[model samples]
Target: MTAFCATGAFAADYVPGELVVRIPPGGNVQAIHDAWGTQTLEQLSLRSYVVTPPAGVNVEDCDQWLDADSNVESADPNWITESPEAKSAIIIVAIGSSTTQYTDQGAFARIGLAEAHQYSTGQGVRIALLDTGIDPSHPVFQGKLIAGYDFVDDDADPSEIATGVDEDGDGLTDEGFGHGTMVAGVIAASVPDAEILPIRVLDDEGSGTLASLIRGIDYAVSRGAQIINMSVGLAFESEPLENAVSDAEDAGALLVAAAGNENTPTEIYPASFGQVLSVTALDSNDVKASFSSYNEEVDVAAPGDGIYSTYPGGTYARGSGTSFAAPFVTGAAALLFSAGTPGEPGDLAQSLTDSVVVVDSLAGNAPFAGNLGQGRLDVESALTGYLAEQATSVDGAFRPYGVQFFASPNPFRGATTIRLSTPAGTTMPHELEIYSLQGRRVRTIRSDSSDRGAWEWNGLDDRGRHVSAGVYLIRSNAGSLQSVGRLVHIR
Candidate 1:
């Protein structure tokens, strides 16, 4: 393996309990277009989300993730300033490049996921591609597409015509490039057995209004789509859209969103919402994508740089952005869901995070502690982990609130950090108190205004005094809400 350069980020080892976070993508529509040109989400994001996992996973392929000539280090300067923490090793896109006709790598190439093929390509699963409209006759969709409704015109034949068959008498086909067709190819194409529900939410401009996305979400839920891949996201997070996603989650559907390529920590929605799994892209190294979002909004990472996949007009092209990486995670999720793994969206979410293997350590991936949350998605590993965890029944009391917490560099030397979440717009003061193992209160820190979405603390007492090396507890209080986390201070 090639030597990896250090980015001062620690390697996020693949621990079974760790959550697979696909953070590190651009934040929203504007940012995504800023990363790429003016492209639509349903095409860029959903197509990747709906596709199937590659034939197999392997260490050698992971090695390619680190190669300088690999996807992560392409010509796109959007992330040139950002580097993967691991060495030449990296988390590569398991599937072939769209430039390669989005075809399956020969049997010899898919050695990474040797056992993955044993499972189905989610053939029977129905993934509704809500974008412009699909070319129903695409070779990949030979027999995989199902009858879909074009809400834009309320038409039965929802083709990507100059105007979609205005299903709702809106006299508009929605706005978008030929994205629906691309997205359908990713999902149903990869999993030939999987069926597609093509719903056009946008017009021909490759853009759609907020209302259109909400309606599209509702449409997918009604169609019994086990996996609804939403590759597009808005610049601003809307409460109405979030509520619709909440309903989708309640309806036993998996919604995959693309983390925008903003090159900062800004988060895009519905991917950044409380429960949604926001996916980011990685070159070979397991590092926080420079254009990817951070600050806990991201849940996992996948391959997105210089990604090759199916394009319009039966062509293939290579593109970069978090939009491409989302499908890998979505495909993995579909595979797991089809396998009948049991759990709530949260549990399934956790298992998915725990299932992937950190592939980037060679291409300077050691320092990205949480950049590529839970590393790259490993088909067999994720499936295996999901099945194993399924056997272990619920062990703890259920968490009533949707917030989550974490402590990085757990057994810390200089400083141990703790982060807390209490949703957005909470009208209450929160505090994080530190106590010694003996239950003695040593320090008290309150959640100031900076605790917008979540709060964090480096292992220290109220007086800015570092504590002794031992076990401690961080008690979180958000007005009426309370939670606790065990802390271990080292050195």
Candidate 2:
């Protein structure tokens, strides 16, 4: 067996003398091994196996040889991927006060998370976070985590731990520790109600092989993950990894990945794949970060500079990289899924791309205009536009009201004007009712005067008390006149 190195500098791009291969469903494994002078090391799946070639056979040559065999479905070297975060980019800060409460960080406000939350908090959605694992016991993840597996250690507990040595020779031990926790924290801050499934693929040195990544993705899909967040990247493309991505997409899971932080136009695998939603990093001013990679493959940009999020030992830290930027897009996806956005993952991705706040016109991003993707993420716009589109698509064939009913500033904080448009000769008394999502009527506005065409809602209940922020349904029924509209109230 080839010895694997624990240090990043000594690690090879692909495992020597080892190949990941997929055989026909019922192919004879022994016969194929004998023909190729190779031995199966381990079976990854029913059709896939990690095999070692005979002593003198060159690994790359054997890979090509095996790939040409009709019995072999696919074969390739086991490529390695590393966590995209740079050690210097991270700044860990100890939580000074034990009573420090969890709140949305500045990045949240920059991405319009508060307004987005008024629409959907990602309730019932599951995000599979594939990284170096997480500090599961952290206060930030307290009721927000689900059962996860650690492919690195082949264990059930996917918690972050230090190796006590600087494997990367960067003078910092466990440099990648708490990386998963921070990524999870970003998702939690965006959608606190979303369930995070922490799958540990990368080791403490922030390095993992393509084999582990493929397995992790399969496990996430099998566990019913609605969204998968991969904050890791590899420079070279791997066929098996792409296959796994395709499988995940086919099973209805949306994959979001970080465009590597190399500050170059070079594409990174998984992120460069057409199926995945590639994310780039943006600074507080909406300018692209210095370390963030920009390419045509990037799907969207998000605030990643000095991102404050959860760390190990019940503390919070600030970090920066495309690694952190990817989660914001993941969180946005969860929010859309939770709000019952209809359609496949592709449709949802398009919706998000369409809703981006265009940053290309900004002076800071002028040089990289078309390479930065559609623009920076705007969660509020994504949700609001989706809701509006849904409202417009509703079956409006039957017009009982003989008028059009709508609201200006549909998602309002204090008040919104409900407008009713009718034909010049048409005048009818209407009673507008406001009900919570649970179908309980909260307030009623009666219009006995036919001349009135609009009414203002002060975001108050029928008892003249303020109602909690949430989605509300507005319906008007006067004899045969009936119309319904949706309203989002924010506090």
Candidate 3:
């Protein structure tokens, strides 16, 4: 391996002990570390490693040394920065002892979630909240939260702590103490039953390193998170950060991030990544929030101005920013996932983009129209539109809300593959039973023990007799959940 000097901030000289580096695929990270006379600290992913150099070495020299080897992608200092906690303007309404109703306010009805709630409550969906720790004891999250890890404190208690120290040196102390709890509240409002997994990537001051963010992503994916809500982002580009986002997407988890509140189109990590669904903020008037960042990467918009949601200490507060806007989409996606919606991540994302109602107030306004994404989120429209599409299929069957098992090449010449989309890391006994339209069992097939399993059918009855060319019903039974789909067989 040969090192290639990377330009920019890496060119600066600084005393360094630890660094984050990405090694080439299938290469020995340990051997590479030994060649550089460094000790391995941890492995972020299969190809990403954290190592520290021997005494008297600077970060700039280490970059140059690692760049000389061809097995390295890029090596940079273990850079630390606050999660994009930059909100353009925040109107914080203190929570007193008088509030009881949190989601009954205008934000719920404005986004059309009140109507959407009748259909799905985001049950059985696991959403990973990557931000400041959450207060799980809050009544709104009484039975909604799952145990999550705290990367900042390296403990199991992922609860928000109050520290008056300005860890980010932003001239503020504990600015992000209750940020994660608020984000979780917005999601609950839309998908009240979705399981909230609070992964604390940011500290009490709302500050953390890129390495910590990467660790949070790794943890979320391993735990089978269907949707990851990152109400945080980084300003500058980092290869390690980008690679982590790609890893999450490849694992079949949907990534959602908040567009910066800097009021500029400047891109932010994870949010800018192609695999992530970036969200911008909007106000109750159905207009773009004055502070939401405008960019080509923005995929959807949600209410962010003066949004009312759950706060720490078992109270409700009104806050505003793109940070709060993102959970609405997260919750909406969770609702679909829990309903056993079948489609790739991109397919699900397209459903949302198509369901957005174009606003006349913002259309042709050039700036807002071009950058505010399709339009503000309408959960009722998105869910109704998705199910409506399913009902109009070839078989005219309704597969409403349940487990999803569908087959391709329905009009099969001889055989077809049935794909099952289950919750991540789920392994259970299931069988695919094919039957004639007249209710005679044709063939029974079993799926592999994995979240995503597949099986094939050969148009034959249990006696190995070729059934007459006709339509067949394929039903997938997994414990208490079952889904029915149609198939056409021709002789």
Estimated TM-score per prediction?
A: 0.53, 0.79, 0.77
* Count of steric clashes across candidates, in order: 76, 0, 9
TM-score head-to-head 1 vs 3, winner: 3
Instruction: List where candidate 1 sits over 4 angstroms from the true fold.
Output: 1-101, 105-114, 161-176, 284-291, 359-371, 389-491
Best by lDDT: 2
Candidate 2 steric clashes: 0
Model 2 clashing residue pairs (backbone): none
C-alpha positional error of residue 11 in candidate 2 after TM-score superposition, expressed in Å: 10
lDDT of 1 by residue, 1-491 (tens): 12121121212211111111111223233332343233332321221111111134221132232233221111110001111101112222333323344555221122133354344356446776766667776566667788887755667776765545543342444323445555565565345566788877655544444445666787788788877776666554444456567778988887777766666666667788876788887764445555555535767887666545554455554455566567666667766665443356676677678766664464555454555566666766666555443323221232465345566655455654556655666444356677764578988766556654344556567778766544566666566666666654543
Over 1-491, each residue of candidate 3 has an lDDT whose tens digit, in order, gives 43332345634322146677777777777777667677788777677777886567775466556756776776666665454553332445766644444746787787788666655676667899999889888888889999999988889999989887776566777878788888888888888878889999888776676677888898999999989999776666667777788888888999998987887888877788889999988877778777778788899888888877877898878888888899989988876665434567776787787898676366433566668778888887887666555432232232443356567775565888877665544444467788764577879887666633688888788888886544567776555556677665545
The order of the candidates by TM-score, greatest first, is: 2, 3, 1
Q: Please give the distance, in angstroms, between residue 417's alpha carbon in candidate 2 and its true position after superposition.
A: 13
What clash count does candidate 1 reach? 76
Best by TM-score: 2
Pitting candidate 1 against candidate 3, the one with the higher lDDT is 3
Report how far off residue 303 is in candidate 2 (Å).
0.6
lDDT of 1 at 350: 73
- Model 2 lDDT tens row, 404-423: 67787866779998876665
Lowest summed lDDT window (length 10), candidate 2: 1-10
